[model samples]
Target: MSADIKAWYLSKTVWGGVLAIIASIANIAGFGISGAEQAELADGITALLAAAGGIVAVAGRLVAHRKLK
Candidate 1:
């Protein structure tokens, strides 16, 4: 109902994390990707996680420096 709640659900970072987790679980369950596309999938997952980490770090710094609301 609240804007913050809706905003969080629409967050790219949140979705990225969710997708990464799901992919990891699928891979662990023997449904892992292979062949020519595996490398592309791995690269995407890596970038997604890395972006989430970088964003969180930047947000934290901004909050600490009194720049973010």
Candidate 2:
């Protein structure tokens, strides 16, 4: 993978697959997630991950003794 490319964890496909497996498990437990609901969940999770990454980046810079070149 190139440095410019985002990680697989940030991908919609990866998140959607995770949601699918979760939905399947929920189905076995008699709970349900509709298609629209799954899409919404995936979108929300993706945004949340991006925000967390941003926070980590900012915190790392704040905590670093060496200044950016």
In model 1, how large is the Cα lDDT of residue 58?
A: 86
Model 1's TM-score against the true structure: 0.44
Give lDDT: candidate 2, residue 30: 100
The segments of candidate 1 whose C-alpha lies over 4 angstroms from its true place after superposition are 1-33, 65-69
**Where does the lowest 10-residue lDDT sum fall in candidate 2?**
1-10
lDDT of 2 by residue, 1-69 (tens): 587899887888899999999999999999999978998999999999999999999999999999988
- Candidate of highest TM-score: 2
- Against the hidden reference, what TM-scores do the models get? 0.44, 0.89
Q: Give the Cα error of residue 51 in candidate 1, in Å.
A: 0.8
lDDT of 1 at 14: 62
